[model samples]
Target chain A: MRVFRKQDEMTVKKLVTYLVLGFVGLFMLLPFLWMLSTSVKPASDVFTSFENPIKAFVPRETQWRNFPRVYDTTRAMGGGFARWYLNSVLVAVVVTLGQVTTSACAAYAFARLRFPGRDKLFLGYLATMMIPGAVTMIPNFILMRKITEWLTVVAPMVDWDASRVVSVFGRTYDAGRLVGLDSYFALAVPAMFSAYGTFMLRQYFLSIPRDLEEAATIDGCGLFRIFTTIILPLSKPALATLTIFTFMGNWQSFYWPLIVLTQDSMKTLPLGLLSFMGLYSTQWSLLMAGSMMMILPMIIVFLVGQKWFISGIQLGALKG
Target chain B: MAQTTRGRTALAGYLFLLPNLLGFLAFTLLPVLASLALSFYAWDLFTSPRFVGLHNFIALMRDRDFWYYAYNTVFLMLAIPVNILGSLLLAVVMNQKLRGIVVFRAMYFLPSIVAGVGTYLLWRWIYNPDYGLINTIIASWFPQWLSDGIRGLGVEWPPQWLTSVTWAKPALMFMSFWTVVGGYNMILYLAALQGVSPELYEAADIDGANAWQRFWAITWPMVSPTTFFVLTMSLIGGLQGGFEQAFVMTRGGPAGATTTISYYIYNHAFTWNHMGYAAAIAWVLFAVVFGVTLVNWRFGGRIVHY
Candidate 1:
């Protein structure tokens, strides 16, 4: 009887846990479900379907064309969703690749190679992580503007047309507008060197056994060779974690991009989506469709790299 | 030979660090210092910067709008404690070794992963007064008398959530809670819980301690370190946050109901071109963050167990 009672209590406890979990899970999922439902509904149905909760989530007929309609409307408004999508991809990829490479190289130095003031320098990097982005925003903007001014002044002296045009990937670009304000350089360059990434990668690199590097050294291996052959290969998980994080961060980045990119063509997805919202505030269906497009890649990336994402967050908190 | 090799290693180290160092100097270090210097001077982009000593900081003190926005920032941060507790509870539930728990964890974490302007926009739509999800549900599901009772409490029948001045801050807080309840805090707590020794739980069982007792006595103290860490991070982040939400969702609101300090800085710096004032506000924000972090460390360190 005692044993049976204990088993019953255990079962009851498990059931209670499941009940709580399920309730919270439903609360979490409802917003996402509503987003999907709204994305497929006609504009009129958005306000009407709310009278019935079930009907609100299940449209009478899925407006499959709402997706394409968003593309059309945004394109008509001077910024195409496809262009913003490509820009987001390009910026995220560049920032991620650049950050990882720079961070890894720096992490290798900090973790392995002994140098004077290395610890102090690493500490400085760590301390800057606490400084808010607001402090850097104004000066950086000014810096970019100055660079643009300098380029404008020097372009003519070098016999180059600052407004020279080129086209690639079916998109037109000002070939001479290589760097500075409102350019891809503004979007990708400043973000490429992250103290957080360096700190995280350095922590990971410190954990790597030094014996392999030592052995390579004994065999007359150069520092760069050992880093390339051994450290880079071994730190794949760390590299991957940083890559996914930086990509997602840059992809979802809104503030700096908003401040920097004034041209519709230069706008990223978040900015594009915001402008789309501004234009079609009343059109819930189209707005939802635009948002769905913006959110889908992040969801896919999260699902694919969730293991690293979760572990990376945990690793970051370890020091904190 | 040894000295030569050491010098070569140092050279290699500097070489490896060159790219990041240059970027950091130009971007972060220089900008930080320049922002401080700019705070002491007045410049409106086209105009030359004129040093005005402590004028900007003095003006900031007298600026009623700054205080109001600072209050708004703090008001929004009221969600942090609730979020911490909610995530802790969620993490406790997630730390269980039950079947299909990972799916539930993933579901809970979904909102946080999708957090951005898109999520904010979705919430804005959901907070729509006439046709929003919450009001519609309340209108449909609630008994007429209950709705009337709520109406009697001075809130509108379907509550003008994002529209009403009184409800806007609360509405944003609610959205913040929903977004962060199962995010990094929960994951951190889950990691912390997993690190706890099962032997302690066995000992508690031997003492015939109930679930609540076990949690309060053993679990709480064990996870205090993580709690301290989470609290500090959340506080710092909360202080700096609200810019995106204010910009994307409310545009600093119906009547400046959601204008945080960060948004205030943005307006001054970018919109109004009060560069010195904006820089001063940014520096003040940094000071507050620094002071708060120090206090958190001082107090939280005492409570946190190894």
Candidate 2:
């Protein structure tokens, strides 16, 4: 009787655990499910009565054209969804590449080389991380504006038309609009040098054994060559984590882009989606469709790098 | 020969660090210092800066909206404790050995992954007072008599979430809880849980301790380090957050009900071009964060077990 009671209690506990997990999982997924359902629903089906919640989620008929409609409508509204998507991709890719390269080189130096004031300089970088972005934002905005003014003055001297148009990937670009407030340079350049990335990579680099580097040094390999062939190849997981993080961050960046990129063409996905929301505030179906597109890439990136992402967070937290 | 090689190594180190250091100095370090100096000078972008010692700081002190927004910022951070607790609970549950647990964890983490303006927009639709999902669910699930009873208490049947002043901050807090409860905090706790020794739990079982007792005595203290870390990090983040949410959802609201300190800073600097005042406000915010962090470390270090 005692054994039977124990088994029954264990079964009850397991059942309760599964029930809690299932219920919470459903609660977590409900909003995404609603978003997917609403994106396919017709406009009339959106504001359903409170009689049947299940019926509210299930559309009368799928409106697959809502996606294309969102695309075309946003394009016509001067904030092209495609253009924003492309810009987000381009900026995220460039920023990730730039950040990884710079951080790795800096990390390699701090980890492997002996230099005066190296630790002090690294501590300075770490200290800056504690300063809130709010303090720096105003100054950065002013700097961008000053740079734009300087670029405008220099463009005429260099015989470059500020309004000249060029085409790449079938998209028109203002060719001379480089390294200024509304340009890609402003969007991608400043974001490339991250103190957080340098710190994380430096921690990882410190863990790598010195034997490999020593062996390569005896083989007459240069420092850059050792970094490229040994340190980087060994630190793939750390590099991947930083790449995914920076890409996701830049992709969904809103505030800086909103401040800098007033031109509709230069806006990223988050700003573009905000403007779309403003224009179609009442159109729930179209707004949901745009939102779905906006988050799809992020979801994909997250799923792909899910392993490295979780481990990286744990690594940083534990080490720090 | 050794000296020459040491010099060469230093040169290589500096060369390697040049790209990042130059950018960091120009972008981060310089701006930080400039922001501090700019706090003492009044400049409206188009005009030359004029020195005004302590004027901006004094003006900020007298500004009623600034105080109210600071209140809003603190009020919004009230969600952090609840979020941390929920994350801890969820992490404890997820640390169990079960079938397809990874899938469940991923589902819980999906909201945080999709967080940004997109998620904010989705919540805006969900929080719509008229035809929103929450209200619709509540209306359908609750019997008419129950809602009638609620209305009899002289309360609104469905809360006007974003539109109403009293409900807006709570609404944003609710959204934040949902987004963050199963996010990185949970993962960190899960990692912490995995690091706990099974021998302790076995000893507790041998002592005839109940499940709840085991948790409080063994699991809780064991994970206090992670708890401290999560609390400190969340406090810092929560104090600075609510900018994107306010900007996207409520435009700082019907009556500035949702405006956070960061949003206030943005309006002052960007919209009004009061660069000096904004910098002053930002410095105050930094002071608060720094003070809070120092307090956390001083007090939290005592409570954490190793």
Native interface contacts kept by each candidate, as a fraction? 0.75, 0.78
Model 1, span A1-320: residue lDDT tens: 88799899889999999999999999999988888889998878887745666766788889989999998888854457988898899999999999999999999999999899999999999889999899999899888767766666767555222434567898875432467666788899999999999999999998999899999999999999999999999999889889988999999998899988777777899999988888778999899888999999999998889899888888888688
Give the Å error, residue A152, model 1. Answer: 3.7
The parts of candidate 2 lying over 4 Å away from their true place are A151-156, A159-161, A168-176
Docking quality class, candidate 1: medium
Residue range A39-83, candidate 2, lDDT tens digits: 999998887674767888888899999999988998864448988
Please give the lDDT score for candidate 1. 0.89
Proportion of the native interface contacts kept in model 1: 0.75
What TM value does the first chain of each candidate achieve? 0.94, 0.94
List the TM values for chain B, per candidate: 0.97, 0.97
User: Per-residue lDDT for B193-304 in model 1, tens only?
Assistant: 9999999999999999998999899989999999999899989998888999889988998799999999999999989988888999999999999999999988887888
Off by over 4 Å in 1: A153-164, A169-176
- Model 2 C-alpha lDDT per residue in residues B114-232, reported as the tens digit of each score: 89998999999999987888888887787789888878998767788999897899999999988999999999999999999999999999999998999999999999999999898
TM-score of each: 0.97, 0.97
